[model samples]
Structure formats: C-alpha cells, structure tokens
Target: MTSMIRMFSLAVTAMLFGLCFAAPASAQATRTWISGVGDDVNPCSRTAPCKTWAGAISKTAAGGEIDCLDPGGFGSVTITKSITLDCAEGIGGAAGGILNSGVPGVTINDPNGGTTPTIKVTLRNLTIDGAGVTQGTYGVRFLSGKSLTLQNVSIMNQGTGSVPAVSFEPSAASVGATLHMTDVDIVNVQNQGVYITPVSGVAVSAFLNRVTITQAAIGFKVEAGGTATLIDSNLSNNGRALWTASGAATANLEGVTIAGSLEAAVFATNGTTIRLSNVGLYNNAFGIKTTGTGIVQSFGNNRLGPDAGSIGLPTATVTQK
Candidate 1:
C-alpha cells in the first residue's frame, strides 16, 4: 500500500510541473501599459508602457498588435503592420476613452516601401474628436493595405481644414483594396466623413458601410476614379451629402435620408453613375443633383409623400446598439 501511494503522488507532481511552465507561454501575449503622459521610449509593460503613440507603433511587430491606454489618444503614426490599435474602447486592450476635445485623434500614413506586406486592421468602439484644433491630419488614413475595417467608431469636430474622418489613398503599385466602415458616426468635419481616391486607374474601392454624418461641410466624398458605396446611412446638414468627382465611379445610394443640405444632397459630377432606390430627399436644396455628363438613374421609389421622407431599403438600415 505504501509503494502504490508514493507512485501516485509522484505522477501528480510531474503533471503539475508541466502545467506551470506551459501556462505562462500560453498566456504570454505582450501587455503594453500607458500613463496619462506615456511616451514611446519606455518599456511597454503595464508599469513601463510606452508614452507616445509613435513609440508604441515602433514596438509592434510586423503583423503584431499593441493597445494603448492613456488620458489622451493623440499623435501621428505610420502603420506597416497588421495591428489592432484601440486607444478608446475595444477588447484585448483598453476600454476607456481619453481623446480630448481639442487634439489630433490619429494620423495613419501608409507603407512608404511601395508595397504593404500587412493584412487587415480592425478598429472598433472608439471616439475621436478634433475640436477646432490644428489641422488634425486625419482621424484614420490608409494608403496601401488588403483590408481595413472601422466599426462603431465616432469622428467628430475635426479642425477646419482637416482631411476626412476616414481616408483611403491607393498606391500606384497597388492592385486594389477595400475599406469597410460600418456603424460610423462623423459630425462637424470640414472636409468629408469618409473619403477615397484611387490611384488613377488603380481600381481600389471604398465602402462607407452604414455611416452616419451630421453637420459636416462635405459628407461622403468619393474622389475621381474611386468607386464607393453609401448604404443605409443618414447625412443631415451637410454642404453636399454624397459628392462624386469622377464619372468612372459608381455610387449606389439606397435607403438613405438627406435633409437640409446647402447643395444637392447627392451630386453625381463628371461621368459618375449614381443609382438610387427608396431614398428620401428633404428641404434646403436639390435632393439628387447631377452635373456634367454624369448620369443619375433611379429604379427605386424616390417620392414617398410630403410628410414621409425615407427610403425603406434593407441595406440602408441602421440599428444602433
């Protein structure tokens, strides 16, 4: 009986030893810390988290990620890696917001090496405010990438000449890419809510998926040669709701509501082909205005009634959580 008990005890001890060493490696993800005035030169641990956003960007491994928790989510940084940086709110990182009312939110410069070796970056559940500050650069900018998705994010009150809340700038060596922005709220931006410009015939695409814009000088501006989609969205009190510059681009505005704009809510300039279905156009200016040789084709219901102004389309539906 004594011999059997000793053998069993030894087996249990061996098992526990194996678990202890393996546990740390399994949970060995890097946890970078942040202070109210954190900079990049510091060690990225909880106690020695990097200080500046630029600092954290340098430590992120190519395709690795780093989340920063601070009192102000400021600074300009370039991304060439597959990273998920959530300074405001997201899982696996910080869940509180520190974006001051008057500061730069984030500036994303694309890979300067001509080719971007990274994959996708998903930023969700954050608030970015550039309240009449300096030219805030951009809330988020992408030059070369496979995919980029922004969900449940807010970009409000950027400076007077700040770029767009979200911008996609394609490279000449780029094939094509997609930017999926869903459930985004942009207001009081001087330029645009979401902007995209393909590299002359580079064929990149931009999708303002489920975006809501209020009080923007220009709402969703699809520059020349960029194909864009505005689905299930609301643009109110803008200079122009959907501004298209190129005729080569196509805009499908379905289930959208535009009220009180300075100009035509939807302006299809150049040779742009704009399709509208079940869309509502309200007072202040022309609802669906197209200039030049651009074509505005409507197959869906445009007029619902005098009191009712809303296009009922499934793709244009937005349910806030």
Candidate 2:
C-alpha cells in the first residue's frame, strides 16, 4: 500500500510540472495598435504596438479594429477579414497614410470559411499615395468582399497601367458587393477614378456622396452587372466624366457636375442606360453621347451649357409626378 501511494504522488507532481512550463497558445487581441516607432514582434498592445498595418492585422481579432498611435505611413496592407482601421480618433487628428509603389495600397479579399468568415471592411481618415514614377498599381483593389465603405479617404497619383483609384471587381463568391463612398477624392488616376465592373452574372452597386474625381481617363465607369448613383459629386477634366459600357449597366446622377471632359461628358454604349436629374454639364466636348442602342433619360431638370460642342438629346424626358 505504501509503494502504490508513493507512485501516485510522483505522477501527480510530474503532470503539474509539465503544465506549468508549457507555452500558452497565442490568441488574437480584440484591438491592436500600430506606431512608427514600434516593432512587429511586440504584442500590439497600447504600450507595445506593432510597426506596420500588416503586422498589427495578424494580431487583431477578425472583427476588431487597428488604430494608429500617431502619424505614420502604416504601409500597404491586405485585409482578409472584417475589420476597421480608424485614424480619425487616434492620438492626434493626424490621418494615417499609405505610400505604395508597384503594388496596391490596400487589398480586401475575404473568402468564406476563414477564421473570421466575414467580408466587410471600413477605411476612414487615410490618404493613399501611389508615389510618382514608380507609382502603385491601384489605390484600393477589392477582389473579393461583401462591402467596402470609404469615409474621408483620398487616393492620388495612381499612374500605372490602366489601374483605377478604386477597383471593385468581385469574384463569383463575392457577388453583389456593395460600395459606399462619402467625402472621397481621387486624383490623377490612369484609368477611371472609380471602376465598378464585377464578374458576369454578378451585380454590384455603389453610392457616391460628395465624391470628386479629377484628371483621369474616366471619372466613373460602370460595366456589365454594375450600377451606381452619384449625388453632389464632381467629375472634371477627364477623358470621359461618366461611362456605362456593355449591357445591364446603369448610372444615375443627381446634383452632380461634369466639367472639362475631353470626350463626352456622359457616354453610354452597348445597351447601357444613364439617368440625369439636377445635373450640370459644362465646357465638355459633348453633353451626352449614346451608341449601340444605349439610352440617356433626363428629368429635364439638368443644366447644359450652351458652349458645349454638341448636346446629344436624351432618349426620353421623364416627367416628374
């Protein structure tokens, strides 16, 4: 009996020793921090923040937020889960910045069955700069995501090959992705400022409020399976201010302004349609150009400048009730 009792005591002691020395599993934090002077190996806590946005994202929870500690170029990051990066409420009102070259400033690709398992992203109070010469490919390249909201965001100098400031081309699984842009400004983009061209048979929608696009090939382009509404927005000095290509693409403009377009102010082709209400077209080569059975319906409340090279008549003037 004494021998058995001694063996039992020894086993219990050994088990407790192993439990104490074993390493604890790593768990993501509900909130992570990033700073210019921080290190990536840190825990991303307030006192021990990470160095870059890419570093802190791995430490942050799926639906959590990563906040900036101060003014820093957090570097380019790829988001694969639902998260928010808010720099407006950080230590100072210093907006977070991303300076990218030869790559996208931000990429949001959230597929299903991942750890987070959601496809929503929000970006606020940031400036994405595609540095000149070796400029980045895209300011924001959204391949697969449910929705993306940009508030007070500025993207500029994306002079690469046919890359827009914001590209929303979702995959089949990411169909019906929604985009909301408020107080957003895009400048000097090589392609369209905002391109909403999803995959075939997949529809996407966009809402633009107080958005501005300047010095681009096209300000806003909506292709097949795409729809957009622009309110109180400005598209100026572009090859084409607004364009809807292919079938099933629709665009509505209200209280919007198109000025100094080298080509037509509004171009619709391939059975697409555009509706205008309370819109102003000034100093453009043409007010509205439609081809290939495309249509432009006006509510007769638009202001077209008399100096335009030509003003294409609307297919029909809609009567207000």
Go through the candidates in order and give the C-alpha RMSD of each one to the true structure: 8.8, 3.2
lDDT by residue (tens digit), candidate 1, 85-159: 665553335543325344445544456426652466766666676654454546777767677888778877664
Candidate 2 residue runs with Cα over 4 Å from true position: 1-25, 90-93, 113-117
Error of 1 at 188 (Å): 0.9
Collision count of model 1: 10
lDDT of candidate 2 at residue 320, scale 0 to 100: 78
> Model 1 RMSD to the real structure?
8.8
True lDDT of residue 122, candidate 2: 91
* TM-score of each candidate structure, all chains considered together: 0.76, 0.91
Cα lDDT listed for each candidate = 0.66, 0.87
For candidate 2, the TM-score is: 0.91
